[model samples]
Target: MKLTQIATATALFFTAQLAFADNPETQTQPAPAVEFLLPSVEVVASPPSTPLFSITDPKAPRQPLPASDGADYLKTVPGFAAIRSGGTNGDPVLRGMSGSRLSLVANGAPIEGACPARMDAPSSYIAPESYDKVVVVKGPETVLYGPGASAGTVLFERNTPRFTEAGVRASGSLVGGQFGRNDQNVDIAAGTPDVYARVTANKAHEGDYRDGNGNTVPSAWNKWNTDVALGVTPDADTKLELTAGTGDGNARYAGRGMDGVRFRRDSVGLHFEKQNIGKVLRDIDARVFYNEADHRMDNYTLRETPPGSMPMAADVRRRTVGGRIAATFDLSERVEWVAGADWQVNWLASRSVMGIQNLSDMPWTPSATLSNYGVFSELTWFASDVQQVIAGLRFDRAAATDDRQSISGMMSSMPNPTFDEQRTRVLPSGFVRYEQNLRALPLTWYAGIGHTERFPDYWELFSPNSGPAGSVNAFAGIQPEKTTQLDIGAHYRGGAVDAWVSAYAGYVNDFILFTYNTSMGKATSQATNVNAEIFGGEFGATWKPDGHWRVGVSSAYAWGRNADSGAPLPQIPPLVTRFTVDYTLGAWSAGALWRVVSSQHRYALNQGNVVGYDFGPSGGFGVVSLHAQYDINKRTQLTVGVDNLLNKAYSEHLNLAGNAGFGFPANTPVMEPGRTAWARLSFRM
Candidate 1:
């Protein structure tokens, strides 16, 4: 800590930050800099030396959005699907796998909410416009992110910035749409030779939407978020950055039993990047993050209740703290190695009361804590110009501990006196892949095999009433789920357009299933050690048929079956297809899109549908949309689009049913959002 030593460390640190700047400039400032640490590098992006897709490419037309939760964004890519939960926050599924199978990482941090009902899911906290990149890896392709993700891993990242010359940059947008909806967004940044700062904010609001049937459904929502970032960039490949943000919003659900009264989030994180770390290590990254969510739900909001009826209410909050440090080593031109360790801890609690008077008598339970730690390593080697190899391994330890105990309410009637011990387990996962390039055929072929063993998450444990048979609930009973799978795909790109197709098959030991009964208002779900199999694939094709016209088509399908029970898995998306055609001239481009989905008549027996339980096998429907965009210049663009152009009446297979107290009758069904029109204007400065 001497002045000379401090000076040396500061020089090395600032030099790293300099790398992230788009411009090479250094300024002298006295503001104190904060540092953060992150777990490890996810090696699944591109096995060896290949490049992955970038979210910022201006020429790449954005993928259209569907009536969905954020999971639709994930499904746009190959090897992705979701278990629909009405309209938003759909449970993301990977290669026919769901629940805790997929990993969600925000700003290099891992988080899981505490509600057994999953009302406060981790993805609910993410905003599409807030991040710079979204990467999805199918199947246990990588192990550096978390312990169990038997399905895959998703990474949401905001880029680190650097400064060259003294200047300021800004971008803003305003969007107005039909169905009582509108939005405004702004992104501004300023920097000098040595420092850079960025701020982004956005607000969106919408009222109740009607389905294709023209029937109004209670689907109103309003949300806003702001982010501030600061960085010091000294070189082209290094950066020291800090970020903080706070967001709050409310979303009304027509399919759920309760509406999200409050969705508040606070996040803080720090990141550091270093290139040329040593003789062998090429890059070093460190980051630390803290994120929290406070969510509330009630029956009276967004719906009509019976006269003199007591309201049903619930409130829950969760917080996660995590950090990691990782290094990438380049042993030689043909071989690369990555090593790192990560740890995350989450704490959450909830309070609920059912009475004619909001709150009559009920004690709020103490907080529940779940902790986890893991270390992982991965290596990549280029065997030849036509071949490459990748291998990875990871080990994890996780546990849930209760500080307070009581037989609250409904559980008091049952004899529950054996729950004082801690729950813990060790899990290991690994994967290997082989890729070959066929130059003559203009094709790339890749095949990979992976295995994952994930410990039971909080939702799979304490939320259920039965476990592997001996214990009273999954909390003390269920064992880790083990999964092994093979992934193979091919990509062809030798013409005006490019195309890729990927597929996967897997076997899961101890698949987790949830069973619900409406009469008793009880759900019996458990992680049974039964065998299961799943498979699916997606294909994308884009063609520049003519100079002024372009055609694009994408399709996906998935299937899953419980080998032991001989039944289809619940909540799986059915066969779906999409087509689009666009024509452009001078400064304007017009496009029309069509989507068709087949009915999901095949599902598990007595399984829960998108609603609470087995309530629907919605009829198939078709939707069409039209979009037109005008480009004024390189820095400004305007886009206008009309969704559900036909205004057809239809409900999604995964829709939540209508509430009896709400305007909807007990026999009525939930409705989808009605036809809407939207216009967007963007300006860059």
Candidate 2:
């Protein structure tokens, strides 16, 4: 059933029953307590858009079996893709944009990966099911988050539950699948109105998976996490929360020369909120956080070192500290405003050991330090019931310092020109949007324009061996990226049908791009600046034919061009479409999803982002999945699904080529799994 239909029926049903009891003489006895189960949320590879933004429950069951990280889950959304490396932890890309162009925040903090090769992208540290909500804002539609969000902003948050009385609340799920895949998650809370405490934990493990050809690829992983939150509510309008978390994991990579021996995380945070302060001053929100990641990579940790290759190990670590303060104001009946400021600082260090040496005995070396401070304001104006406007402005100061003393190459060593040098930039960003609702028709249309200036990130400035010509290095040579984009969208809602479409076009000046070259069996990376253009659109429609049946379809397409070289941008995904059919009856619900991806021939050889480069061209493929949900009782539910039911062999366009150690030719893309069955059981109290 459509979401609207279900809501309408529920409202009408309660209204009718209440009207009958208006007269005391006709009042009936109270009905027995009963639970009304809502239809289960079906997992679709490509779901329809939700208004100007999208909010999804991270714990909900999703297709492609189970997502291993935040990136895997985001792929189910249109206009989003993952640069695959192995079974999990693919780097996320949106609208042909990747890297730091996308702002990723968890619990109001940003935790950047430490790998120079991007083996552990930021998303790799995120376990989707651990968070309560996943929120996404596409395009440069808002400037309240921070700078450098030309592609978009993603947030993973956990809501602090407030209690009115003493009680216990809990929710959990267990999952199992083929190839020794299994996971467990649990969340529990108990307390009184004055104070409360909550705890969440999860564990997941999977063995090497076989491709459609029954070939085992070097992909396997195991991880676990635990977090706790304590909250104090002194009054009805105030709340203070303290939170801490820790986690660790290890994974075997299929596209790299080494395996991740450890991915350890430590975090602590404090948040405060106060509401209903006065008429003009609405509320205040403030938060502070600290996060650290310690990662290690070694060729012999998870697998034997290849012949003629020396045993080597590298350890890298990153520490980040940040805080945000915001206030909401009601200037007038038709005007509302939000103003905020955020600041963050990060420290990075690394050390390596070779030839059967003790890694811990080596001292860590400090490499880079980065810091940024931003201030922003957003205002909303309601001209009328059918018209609205929103505008936001932001400014940021970014700074970075290099700490290397010397550089070493295969041939010679040179003084590090940028050593002890600091680079800084002042950036400004803003966006304005106008929305109008048709009086006669159930429709809304909106248009927006945004401009953003992005400073070079850690990878762009420090990872590459060389910078643009005629400069000391990337730190001093690369310029900040500037983007100007226009976005337009429309939404329509009628009796039994709802549809929406959104499109974006943008031009980028001084875009940061990376190129790879090989010499004497060693690869060297170079960073450069270029001009580029990008455009994309996503559309979807859903129709409810009857109370128990619904059908929907969604499609997404993206295109890009490198203006300087007159070549197609690398790592652009092909056009894709999804079809879904759903049925609901009482306590049982079923669904079927079919996904199709078109061929991509655009190629910019040896050119791409840090995660991967384009592999000439990839062919189209189709896959179908079936899922069913059953509500065993008010507090218990079970979901079962089969993905790639036909056992078809396929590889995504944005993929990393398999490494030679994995028994595959160098530069050969890895194949996805085939015909996997999975089941999940969830309970709440």
Candidate 3:
């Protein structure tokens, strides 16, 4: 169905409902006991809940129109950026770090995408609204989730639900906007004291958008997802749950030679939890999960085939299986400890067909397999009322195997130098921290040091065309990356005012880097190692002068240099700041957000990660947005917003060069969407 038709139908339905809700008879009824509060539209994300740790509700209304994917949503957080690839599935970067440095977990399991070029990053499969909570832990501060989190860790989780009696509850949202943008979501749950079931689903679509110059950009997409969970709560303190989910989508990218014609996901999981087992043993948690991503990209699916080029497509898939077991212990009155073990394995395979050949008929070829096993323990010591200490340690055994029989080059296939070869390494990571609270003021401060040893991932090992100098291949030449860092932060929470600042400095040994080179009209990439130094920080403050007024400001910056070459690191985001002001009166609220980014004069041309490479220096730009919300009742809310209010033409420094096949000039960055407006109606029962 056409997006405009869908938007018009949705508008008529919502209008009728609003009118019915205003009827005198309905107005006299008493509200339900379970009042669903509608939070003001989130512009700039709130300050961290604790030093370097942030928690936010994923379901909350946010500006820049509600995000279509996880990476889009994370842009609201300080120190977070994305390498744009059209309108959706941008690769997320944290503190100037991307790829495997940042760990992403969903329901305690890791899901990896299959695209060698990172067309479908891990965040691409995530539908932010389908989850209940988002937790971001910056820096390598903890060891409970997984290993090699030198950048940070992001967790998307769902809380277990319990009921005292048999009952049913549901929540939903409908949104429509310009450029034929629309979305629909529904979540329903039913439960009794002993058992519960839930179903969540959503669909999103958008047409090609125009830039400030009113030129069309090839950035259209459609996606849908559905997930279900069933739980058995035999007792109040113990529960078991099972979950299954499937989703698929397609996206058009103006920065690539092909469009994503398929993004398919399948997953299943089992979880068990028991709390308050004894005085010393507080809780035990165990979970197992299996996830698979089947992705396909083509030149003729979402757009016209380029002149003189035949239709071509590639299909890739990755299957991952993982499990974890953890237990919490109250060792003493002043000390608490949590310990866990985890194991993960994933395999990648692919097939390609050209010249009107059927891709499905091509036999899939297994390319690589990777695995990791780790044990971890974290201890927190409450020494006194104002002083605390935290420490963690983990050991991981990682291994990768190359299964390819031959390497495909620009002209012809060649024998694989490292075919059927395997590499394994035993690595360790740990952290120690000290935190203190001021006795005379509402302030807390912390300092920590952490170290992590990371193994080479798939992209660094197999995607590159060549390895470092004097090496057989990337799979055999790349060495493990070791990072040691120090972090310090402070936060103040006084009545009407809240503020936070976090900073880090790190040195990396054998940091993996990618270099792009084009020769004879063909592009190639090579993987190499270098010594690097990195530092960054994020700061924010919020002031609530009165019950009806709120003002906030946040800023973030990162700097990195290649210690070996004395050159600036590629793909680093420039300094950015956000300002927001909000006013609330009764059930109505209004807000505006202004975001400014500094010009990035420092860059390493043709060097970056698998997602994108630095094309050249980029200029900075500023944009403004505004939003307003009205509560129709305790259970319903309507939010409207205008994005890019000034209709500015801007492009982020961390962006891909426009593809020639899309009729874009060479070495040009894709522009962001122009001025657009949208509205969303949400209800809970």
Candidate 4:
């Protein structure tokens, strides 16, 4: 495809307004805070505006009912998919990559899930409506966050509130939807310029939803969260803050043998920032945080025990503590530099019971511990008014230790092969990018290349039953993986049109893959390494014909291969596209969303990440939804919408097979919810 022509064709894409944020006129200005109480149609299909980066407000009202977790909200974006696990807490996949490859952070702190089965994915604990902004950095284009971000990085952030006088401000929303669905959220702040306090809270609940066939799927959930922050502004450019939060929830799943009975989280953090220290030294930022996940899974709590398996329950916990310190330097008028160092430690332990046993009688046992210490530096250079360059380098010492003493098999128990073993690696990562502005065409072009060496994560090391052919176990034999990738893209804005496109290709030297085998009536999961190749991209455009009418369309696709097996990668999403149209006049507005998904024929059954495996090929499908918004005065708003408007029955390409206990045939993909309607009301004070 011709780069210039494609850029012009997608001129009206969802992120057109986002690209305007980088226009010469607004290049130096910080992005304005966005509120969800008043939403725009374009946000439903939003794309990244800058090269490899996209930013959007998390509280925005969207179709398919307001998202139950971060992963649910991300599916609306191009080049992203979610592995459905029931009604909520689906795992997110980007560019065909899942698990540790995607780094996730909240308020500058990392929070990891403790479930080996991934019932509580990192996104599960995230309440999008509680955060101010959601930022995504696709691919391994930068190393400022942490290691193992081969796919990308996602950040959920909150802005500090500064009050000029002693006063109070608050914003909140109430929502109700089909299947007994209901939700409530509120954010409030109070204090003076020198001191301030803020509180954010939310609760959501839903009952089982029926599929198009009028069959009820075992999906239901109830969740709640609350967070508090206290800050001392002291001045305009300097501030210190402390924050803490706790939340817990439970969910039922149709595709799993066990259900998540408890999903608990606890977090605390302290951060300090100082700007404009001097001429050479621009600023300093530092922070420390502690987070923990306590998870419990059982079949009896939310469902009856399967015929073959006895009643069982498992409890797991992971505690993580980390800190980061960074400083910015003004090397020259055209050059800026940032350097930082970070350290994190994670401890994991677990306990379990069988056959109606009391939970309190089970003894806790240590399982594993992992840690990482890293240092990084990044530089941004302004070559001229239309050309720029940016580069970064990072190094980390990653280590893991096994604490288990024995492993239990279907018939007996034996000494653990990797007991008391420790493994460590020194990994390095770096990236460089160049950007140029076409002064005459109102367009910008960018290209970047990056390489990263990743340490095997816990799931890769300890969860598998076996290792490569000659190795005794996964923990003792797995090796670090390496990835090298290149990305390129362009953006264009013309009168009534806006567009953007990004493409990437990469080679993985040691990709960690899993293989499942059944022998002697027992199932075993083996972890192995292989060389692989991957490539994909996303493009879109938007057109605004008049002051009251707008139209837009966008699409994304991804492909990957296992170099060693000569087979298609498992669980890769199929080509997908979305079309949108909206009209607005005075205090009333309306919009329609149309989504099209292609059939996925490729399959690598029993080979995938921990969350899911390929069930089989799926047929293509389409769904349409419509929504309307009303401004009930400046401080209040009302919005209503219906998803699956035509009541079309469908399932996502990336899905989990239904469990027999749910009355679903073995190896069959679970179906999505049927037609649903919802309404939301908002208030600001």
Highest TM-score model number:
3
Error of 4 at 261 (Å): 0.8
TM-score for candidate 2, residues paired by index = 0.93
Writing each residue's lDDT as its tens digit, candidate 1 over 181-277 gives 6656677889876779989888777677667777666677777889999998887778888999998777776656678878788989998889887
lDDT for model 3, on a 0 to 1 scale? 0.91
Candidate 3 lDDT by residue in tens digits, 1-685: 3557756766776775666556666544543477567777998777788876899887778998899998998989999999998889999999999999999998778878999999999999999988888999889999998989899999999876787777777778888888888899888998999999999999999989999889899999999999999999988998999999999999999999999999999999999999999999999999999999999999998999999888989999999999999999999999999999999999999999877788998999999999999999999999998999999999999999998899998868899989999999999999999999999999999999999999999989999988999998899999999999999999999999999999999999999999989644456889999999999999999999999999999999999999999999999999999999999999999999999999999899899998888889989889999999998777778899999999998899999889889998767899999998998888776
In order, candidate lDDTs are 0.68, 0.84, 0.91, 0.86
Model 4's TM-score against the true structure? 0.93
Task: Record all residue pairs in model 2 with backbone atoms less than 3 Å apart, i.e. clashing.
Answer: none
TM-score of each: 0.87, 0.93, 0.97, 0.93
Error of 2 at 573 (Å): 1.0
**lDDT for each residue of candidate 4 in 329-432, tens digit (9 for 90 to 100):** 99999999999999999999999988888876788899999999999999999999999999999999999999999987767779997899999999999999
The candidate that achieves the highest lDDT relative to the unseen native structure: 3
Candidate 3 segments whose C-alpha is farther than 4 A from its true place? 1-32
Candidate 1's C-alpha runs over 4 A off are 1-69, 78-87, 354-364, 407-418, 521-529, 608-616, 663-669
**lDDT (10s digit) by residue, model 2, range 1-685:** 2334434533453354345435456544442354645336555432324446778778777776768888988888878889988888889998889999998888778767988888889998898888888888888888777789999999888986678777767777777787777778889998788999999999988888888778887889988889999999988789999999999899998988888988898999999999999999999999999999899999998988889889999999999999999999999999999999999999999998878888989999888999999999999999999999999999999999998777766667688988999989889999999988999998888899999999999999988888999987888899999999998888888888888888999999999988888534456778999999999998888888998888988888999999988999888899999888889887788898889999999878878887788758999999998898877666666788988888878889999888776667767888888887877777665
Identify the runs in model 2 with alpha carbons over 4 angstroms from their true place.
Answer: 1-39, 45-50, 411-413
